[model samples]
Target: MGEIWIIGATGRAGRNISAGLRAGGHRIVLVGRNAQRLAEAAATIEASGGVPPRTLVTDDPLAEIAAGRPDVVVNTVGPFGTTTVPTAQACVVAGSHYVDLANEFQPVRSLLEMDSAARAAGSTLVTGAGFGTLANEALVYELCAGRPSPIRVRVAAMPVVDGLGPAVLASVVDAAATGGLIYRDGRLVRTRLGAHLRRIPLPDGTTRATVAVPTGELEAALRGSGAGDVIATSSEVPTGRMARAALPIVGAILRVEALRRTVIRLIDRWQLTPPATPGEVSWAYASAEWEGGETRQAWLQTGEGYAFTSRVAAMVAARLAEGDARPGAFTPGALFGADLARSAGATITLDSTTKDLR
Candidate 1:
């Protein structure tokens, strides 16, 4: 069995991913900021017939993690706003395959910044093993199938419209407040927030919304897979009547460090939480034009973005343990085709002819 190390084991996604690994018969080591949470997570993994992992909690997290020597590292840590690079480095030193549920582009850039180092270490690094990156990258790959020319693609995600977690909220705020990475016209462009918005139909046929978020995968995929013109959307601050009302003020409020802290506190108190269970469902769509004047549509409508991502991480890890994977810092779409990814468990649907948009 492969030795799996899950960092941030105290969080919701980490617990579920640990269980998923346990069910698959991998030895699990739970890592958390607190000793008690790590111990608790280890107990649950053991109860599920998994060999309980050694817990590592210390002030020096990176050094502690490097010593573990795990076979695979699954990090469910959030606010990966920072800390991604060092974590990946620890895995590299340990000679382990590294993966994370990172949804933001900033951390992804930071984590993969060590491409040459990771290659030298013979470690395969995977990011956004979570929903946004997982779904969008996989969907874009499928959308380009059967196309002979440059393809224009758009991608987005809408969590069930209620609200989101604090980490998620912080990310949204960061995206808006910082106006992250963007690429266009064959050049890397970093623009301010809400530069563009479009009306895209949901699976329910209601036109929701779409905004651009930074994407490294799209750039990598375009270069690696011969796709052209990828218009990727990152996670956006929720917009609607309520958002339109509050965002300008929120933007102004978030400018002041004190006011921003207060806003986050109030949002947490309101507690607008998602489900406690692991299977919170999310939907994603990708579309593009192919040869012979045809449009192809492919989508991943799956349960709990994080849960789905965890499984993807497990599958990638199992392949590594089985010695069947290629090594390098490559996007998921570059590593596996749309067909393979779909068979792996994404509810991937592809259609060459689409009247749906009409």
Candidate 2:
């Protein structure tokens, strides 16, 4: 297999993806800003019985990609709003397939806009390999497969993560700055942040409050299901009544570019991260309704959020390294089909009343 270079190799997602790729028998190249940290991660990989991945320490990851010219680049760095376009462009220039754990709508759409360039360069660019987008998008694709355009689609991501890194928190702040977004009437629509809130069902026979956020799953669900109205939400965001009520104000404050940058810097400087409470599983829910009233719903069940993300990213990167992907920019589901989620350790269960298209 071709060498896979993982940017941000010292981060949680990067390390997990490296381990996963190693387990799949793929050679890895760990790239990070700190040589000692990169070496530590490489040692962990070696301890796992995989060959020690080559390490590269560089302040400019894109420069490293351009110079080293790895066959595939798995970018786990964020906020993707700043990194996705530049890294993807570099991948195109380097004739390297690119994949990222981008969940924000802006970055996802930005990457898709590079489809022609990626195709021209004969490289594949995939976004939203993480649980925040993939599991829900995959469920939407399966629920609407073989059906005509759907009138409405709803997707909710509920990840159970052991912990979150400062980068994850920074990404969330960046996404909030983009304001509210959705797909409605076959077009992009904007709304007040947290304009829609609902209690969504889960695989464990329970319900959790979810608030509509501008997640990449909105775009992916719309593309996969051809739905006129789509709402992508997540339990990862604060969903309490007060939190919902304050979302618009918070969003407005962050929308200012300078303020957004300041908040992100503060988060980074403080090393702010979400709590790490282990959970048994993570779940994603999707429901689609056709114009004629035919409806289908599905629940995707998987293990912890980071582990699932690692597997998904590794699978996509390994496939691209093995020449198994097409030369275009795509979401994971649109590119490889929903079944890819199953191969990455996600279990899909359709509603009993929904038609069995499989």
Candidate 3:
């Protein structure tokens, strides 16, 4: 069995990932800062018929990772803007495979910048192994493969989750603080926080209003599709008229370092409940406009977001542990293939009448 270390093991995403790994027959080591919480997590896993993962309590996760030298390390901590770089660096030094569920543009871009280092170390470093990047990135990859680069591309992530935890909320705040970004003229460019509002079409012919956001998918879609202009949106973010008008003001407040931290702390203390499950199915949509005046669109349908994330992360970890990965930083769809999501209960659909991008 492969030996896997999951940092932030006591957190919701971490626990789910741990369970998925354990179910895949991997040996898990639950790593957390809190000893008591680590033990509790282990006990819960054990009660669910999984062998109790070895519990590691540590304030210094990097030291622990270097010491343990696990075959693979999965980081579930966020706001990934703060955690991804250091953790990836540690994994590179430790010569261990690295994977994270980062969805923010900064962290995803930062981790990808470590490709050279990771390759030199003969280690695989993968970022954005979650719904935030994977579903849309995969679609874009599929659409652009065996074709010329598209002139314009748009991707939207619409997740339906039962609930969210403090970490998810914090990550959103962190992204807001970073403000909106897009790929234009073959470069990352800035935009207003709530700009580019549109009603994105779903798999079942329905539509949801989406708002421009600085998500990892923006980078992923651009890189994967070789597109010059790309915009990433999300249904989770508010897209109403009032919300759009207020975004600039709210974004301004969040841009300050101290103010951002204070807002995050206040939000954490408030412990807001995330939007309720939108529906049984979550959809990720991608549309591309080719240079020749042709356009194509597609959708990837999956179960609730958290459950899908667990599967995606586990699958990537298992692949890496089995030596099915290359030495470099990559998004899951880039490292594996567009079909990776389908293996985890995802179904893809293209417009029946038009020339589909499949």
Candidate 4:
């Protein structure tokens, strides 16, 4: 069994992924800033009658990772904007595979851009191995398979998360600070934070409001479909007119370096209440259009967002540990094909006919 290290092992995502990997017979090392919390997290694994996990309490996880090269490292820390590059670089230096559940545009793009370095190091680096990027990017891959590069592609992430944590909120704040971005004629363009608001039709004959946001899904869609024009929207943001009008101003304020850091610090101490469950279904949608007006659409149906993210992250780590991935940087769907989503308990439906693609 491969030895896997989980950074931020005290966090919800980290704990879940650790349990999953351990159950799958891999040795786990729980790494975190808090010795007590890491011990507690390891205790849970031991209580499960699994191999007791090794706990490493350190303020500098990157340094530890570089020193003790595990087979794979799973990063559940955020805002990934700051953590992704340094952690992935540490993995490259240690010749260990890296995986993270990052879905921000900057972090995902930055990680993908390290393909040459990761390949040279003979280590794989995976970003966005989670609900938002994988769910939609998989559909984009499916829609564009065996077809010419599409002229336009639109993907929407509509995750229904059951709870919120301080880290998740911090990530949201980081994304808001990024404003809105879209690929137009194969170029990244910035716009208002809540621009391109649209209502997405669901498979259940309902419509949900979505607004364009700067997310990793946009970059993943662009790569998956080879589309010159790509837009990534999400139902996770506020969609009301007042909220939309205020988003740009809020984004502008958050762009200030000092203020953003202060806000994130405050968020770190927040005791957020878990949100009421949104239901059993979360959906991701993608549509692609060709130059001659031909179009294709697909939807991915899954359960709760966090659950799917944990599963996807664990699955990616397991595969990487098994040496199944090539030496490069990639998003999950790009590296493993669209079937990765299907294997992670998601069902894909295509077009108005609702043909099951699984």
Candidate 5:
């Protein structure tokens, strides 16, 4: 089997993915800056009856990737706005397949723009290989499978994570710094952060509130459904009226480079207490409206958010390592289709009366 290298192996997502890959009988190398933490993570995997993984201690992971050229590289670092391009470029140069858990707009868009380069290099690059992008993008693909391009599309990501690490919080801050974005008439348009608030009907018949945010799901939905107008909302963001009103101002303030950096540094140091898990079920919802009053909607249901993310990232990396993916840059759903979500333990429901698609 080809060797898989996991960057940020000391982090939660990285550790989980490394363990998962190991359990699948794949060779994995754990890379991180802190030798002790990397060893600790590796030891935990070893304790689980898996072969002890090789540990690479390095602050310059990109340089290592460029020189060593592992068969596949899994990046769990964030905010991916800074990590994604450099790491992915290194992988492309080394002809190594790459996967990441990025869901932010700019990084996802920037990575997709490298599709031609990746294809030319014969390197497969999969971004947004986590709950946020794949879950919703799969629904959009299923909802619009055999139809003409939808006139409008909306996707909502409502993940129920057990807890969050500091890196997750930092990514949230980075995303807020990017302001708001949507697709209007097939063109990317800027709008106020938290601009459109909607109460989404859930499969369980309850309504959950979501607000517009500049997530990668926006781009994924646009491309998946071929919709001229698209908006991506999330239950992760503040949806209350007061919070909604303040989002634009907060977004504007964070857009200042220095302030954004400072806020991220403070967030790292604060070491927030993990919040209570929201609920047992996480959901991704999508609704498409075509010309002449035709509409279709769908939902994807899964377990805890982080567990699903770890499974998705590990599965993508494993497939890439095994030569199951094409040589190009893509979001997970676009590359492997909606079955990728099903393989990662998500069930899709096309409508109220329809049976779940396993």
Candidate 6:
């Protein structure tokens, strides 16, 4: 097994992914800002009967990564809106395959913009190695492939299993910073995050307000999957009486920079974003509407959130590193075929609602 570096190792997703890889007998080099945290993550893996991976602590990120030269690097960094290109740049120079749980689209666009350099370095760059884009688009493709129709992909996140944590909060902040982007006019388009609230019915026969969040990988997926339109979102409907009353006020609070800062600071101070006990949750689905043909959909639901996505990314990285796969810049959606995406254990729902073209 070659040296595999796990950046942001202390992160929930990182630790979980690293643990899974270690258990699979791969050598891991854990990297993180906090030495103590990295040690704990390594120990946790070891305690779980996994091979304890080597660890590295760094205050200066890119330089440290440059010196490591691992076979592959799995990035668990969040809020990709504020990106440091050197991280990806150095990985390419180091001849390391790059994978990231990048939920934000702008940085991914920027990273893909470096196709020339990445290919020149003979490095593989795969982003949205997480649940956000790859799983969604992959499943959608599985359902709608070979069927001709303008499709719409929509996702509603339920706070269960791993629940929403700070990383998710950071993701929200990143989306806010960039407003939102969607597939419109047969191209990528931007809109406000809180704008365009639409009510979507859940499986439980209840409805919720869904708002677009661009920090997700949906736009890149729209282009990648060749879908007419793709909309990624979070459920913003008030859950309870108190939440219902607080809806407008909560949006107002998030809008104020100071309030947003205070809320995030409080979460940090309390470590409120760390995942609690994970439950069965998901990041999957594809809804298709057709004019005169069968409309199809696919769904991918994981029993666990951080753990599943992490393990998936780690396995993908290992494949790319160990002569198991090819080297090139790509997204997970672009990595495998429709069948492979389904075998990856994401729940796919295929809907065929057609209007007779009589």
Q: TM-scores of all models?
A: 0.80, 0.96, 0.96, 0.97, 0.97, 0.81
Model 6 stretches astray by more than 4 angstroms: 48-51, 147-159, 196-209, 236-283, 290-294, 339-343, 355-358
Per-residue alpha-carbon lDDT of candidate 1 for residues 1-358, written as tens digits (9 for 90 to 100):
6777778776677787777767777667777778887888778777766456677776666776677677777766555664567788888888888777666666776765667888898888877665566677677766655656444555666433333466556555544444434545455666544434666655556665765555544454444335445556533455455654555555555667676666556655685444332235567766666444567676677765555666776676665655655556655555665544565466777666645331
Q: Model 5 compared with the native: what TM-score?
A: 0.97
Give the per-residue lDDT digits (tens) of candidate 4, residues 1-358: 6899999989999999999999999888999999999999999989999679999999999899878999999999998998999999999999999999999999999999999999999999999999999999999999988989989889999989879678877888899999989999999999889988888888899988899999999999999999999999999888999999999999999999999999888888775433544878999999888866777788999999999999999999999888797999999999999999999999999883332211
Task: Summarize candidate 5's per-residue lDDT along 1-358 as a digit string, tens digits.
Answer: 7999999999989999999999999999999999999989999999999579999999999999989999999999988998999999999999999999999999999999999999999999999999999999999999988889989888999999889787777888889889989999999999989988888888798888899998999999998999899999998998988999999999899999999988888877896534645899999999888776667789999999899999999999999888897989999999999999999999999863222111
After superposing candidate 1 on the true structure, give the runs of residues whose Cα lies further than 4 Å from its correct spot.
149-151, 161-165, 202-204, 215-228, 234-236, 241-281, 290-294, 339-344, 353-358
- Against the reference, the lDDT scores of all candidates come to 0.63, 0.88, 0.88, 0.91, 0.91, 0.64
lDDT score, candidate 2:
0.88
Using alpha carbons, what is the TM-score of model 6? 0.81
How many clashes show up in model 6?
A: 15
Q: Please give the lDDT score for candidate 5.
A: 0.91
Candidate 3 all-Cα RMSD: 2.1
lDDT of 2 by residue, 260-334 (tens): 998889888998997764578888998887655577788999989888898899999999999898999999988
Error of 1 at 58 (Å): 2.7
Model 5 CA deviation exceeding 4 Å by range:
273-277, 352-358
The 10-residue segment with the lowest total lDDT in model 2: 349-358
Model 5, C-alpha of 6: deviation from truth (Å): 0.6
Q: Which pairs clash in the backbone of model 3?
A: none
lDDT of 6 by residue, 1-358 (tens): 6778888788777877787778778888898889898888888888877456789888766787688788888877765544425677888888877888776767777777766888888888877676666666676566656756454555444323445556656655545556556776467786654544555544445555555666445655565556566676654233444544454445555668777777666766675653454345554545555544555544565655555567568768777767665556677777665444455565555545453211
Candidate 3 lDDT by residue in tens digits, 1-358: 5688999999888899888888778888999889999999999889889567899889999988778788899999888998999999999999999999999989999999999999999999999998879999988977787989988889999999988887788888888888889888898888999899888866576889899999999999989988888999999988889989998888889899998898778877897546666689899999888866788887899999988998899899988988897998999998999899999889887652344332
Judge candidate 1 against the unseen true structure and give its global Cα lDDT, from 0 to 1: 0.63
Prediction RMSDs, each to the true structure: 4.1, 2.5, 2.1, 2.7, 2.9, 4.1
